[model samples]
Target: MPTAAHAHAHALDLGRFVMASPSSFHAAAEGARRLAGEGFEVLSEIDAWPGGPGKYAVVRDGALIAWTVPEGAGATTPFRILGAHTDSPSFKLKPKPTTGRLGWLQAGVEVYGGPLLNSWLDRDLRLAGRLVTLDGAQHLAATGPLLRFPQLAIHLDRAVNEGLALGKQQHMNPVWGLGDPSAEDLLGVLAEAAGVDPYEVGGFDVVVADTQEPAVFGAHGEFFASGRLDNLSSVHAGLVALVQAAEATDAEGAPIAVLAAFDHEEVGSASRSGASGPFLEDVLARIGDGLGASAGDRRRAFAASWHVSADAGHAVHPNYPERHDPANHPLLGGGPLLKINANQRYATDAAGAALWATVCGEAEVPYQEFVSNNDVPCGSTIGPLTATRLGIRTVDVGIPLLSMHSARELAGVQDPWRLSRAVERFFAQAG
Candidate 1:
């Protein structure tokens, strides 16, 4: 929490972005817009890799990757890549969703990721995702919107806490406005939002999302909460630093700025756009080529390049502090946490960890350490995938967070901007 005055001073427009990015497509679009506005060229994957000066972007189905090469970059130039994901855990829309219980029509939904099912109850949810539209049999366009997923009230369920359970195909669907909700009805509404013909909407991948936006909470607004912070917080940080990375790249390929936001990490990163797929490796290799790295040079260039996989770290919870490693209980607002998992789940070895610590020190950014107790199995991220794929040195680090996959998560407000600043410094000097 922060005081009102201090809270207003925070630079992040977290609220504007929270609901807009319910799906990775929307996230990619937003970042692409920003980079394009900065005069960065939005490169078409359909085109051959253009190894010229200036900036460029690549957009897959639901993912966007971008970068800026200094004016004189050539075969010897290596990129400084920053990686993060764009998907979040949530309830998703189904094909034949229609349920009526006591005159209330519920929309069908399927769980998307490892969210705390309990926390999703009794919240205002919206539906959002990409829609593919086909015209009279000829024209087609993509549409995206933030839609809703409503939860039942506690009063409706007297035994909510009495070992409450829900069959995903049964009780978890949400009831929207009053009436029978056929896929047609909602598709019409979506068509209106996108200025398309309802008949033109061929298919969609919309998901339920919290209607709430990110907000400053706590006494001084030091604490932030709303929806989709699990990774959007990092997304915001990455974009801001990216905008700045453009300026710093004027140093002649000293440190080329690369932003990697992959899709499908929430599920398995197996999709064409997923971290486990060719998105990262292909993009990095292409960057090597863009910088004039031949096959032999690509290998050597990878040796010198370092990657920072940005994700949220688990924070010490007030009610369950003991759950964390006693010696490394990362606290919120304690700066960023350099996550180290002894099992290599985090991809942060001594060299990687030391790299981050040194960056934090030089930037005067306060930081903490986090590692799950040896007794507790830990989660993983793109760190290992990137390390193994490119043979590039990698590290995992991020702001500490509470309720990682919940519709609404908590993080330190100051940390968001602090991290952007440090990452800016990193991309400016990673070489």
Candidate 2:
């Protein structure tokens, strides 16, 4: 059960998470720090597993998996998995990124995912991601507003309102300042931002992001606005649920709870730390091995596991109502959404959808159904990929929001609280 004050505090915490996590690497580090604060042991892939009743977490690049094993839990015990991605659509910096013309310096960038490129124009942008040093270790760095993409004025383009054209290679470069550009310029700036020497900075994997802080707004604070809400919001919700479930006991026979946050979701999730890779599958196998499970026991445990894909869902846009399915449109403040697609894009089946409804109803959590218009193709998430990879029962679910894939997105103020509650309940309940 959650109180009003608890909900408010959780919203505030979510805001902090959004502000702190400007990149996927930072998001994973923040998640790991939070889990560690709750006394969850950090396990390394190279080391042997400590088999026993305990709370443990493993990190691979930006992806993470944390689980809680209850006292007297067995090898064949079922698992309750809460899944979310840490990465969002943004402009990733490329190697040899210096570019300049007409006394202006710009940084070369590549689109990481399908983002509304127009929204990024003229916005206050910064750089954040991992900086790998000469020694082969990595360090994270976030610089304040250091870049901007100025838009052409109506005076320059008389038909600007008619239809603005943005070329990925030609128009998306963000200008930082007026100076001579060099190969060492961006790295030097990054090193200075991180308070380290430029010589020590060997390479980097950074991205340009919005520098604006997330806030709760609207009349009487009925809405919230933030960048990277497409997935980090779900990450925060799942993190809260995992931490809370670790502190509470389940029913007489409940499954172990696990939270898996993966990176590279924006770029098709094909990397070593991505959903298409072996990160989650390997982590689950290692968890089973740590529990002293045999091959058959591990298979049985996987058969009994369930995964909830927590990503942000689309709320019917007020200005673009025609784009939504008339009968199945979701709205802000509508609580969690059971996202479904007939084309298998979402991985939500009839049984999984019903299970979501049952959990929401039992927790007194408001929920709605979302099916894309027949003509509008649905987007993909880690749900389908995880289900296929691990052969687990997976359901797609999330909070309703507008302006998805934009530089900044919006959601109802109450939705985050409702989502966190529903996810906590999902971990609390069992088959």
The global Cα lDDT (0 to 1) of model 2 is: 0.87
Q: What is the per-residue lDDT of model 1 for residues 32-147, given as tens digits with 9 covering 90 to 100?
A: 88778888888777688877667888888677788877876766566677788888888766775455566666676788988878777777666667777664232222233233
Computed on alpha carbons, the lDDT of every model, listed in order, comes to: 0.75, 0.87
Candidate 2, superposed: residue stretches over 4 Å from native: 1-4, 249-251
Candidate 2 has its poorest 10 consecutive residues by lDDT at: 1-10
In terms of lDDT, the best-performing candidate is 2
TM-score of each: 0.91, 0.97
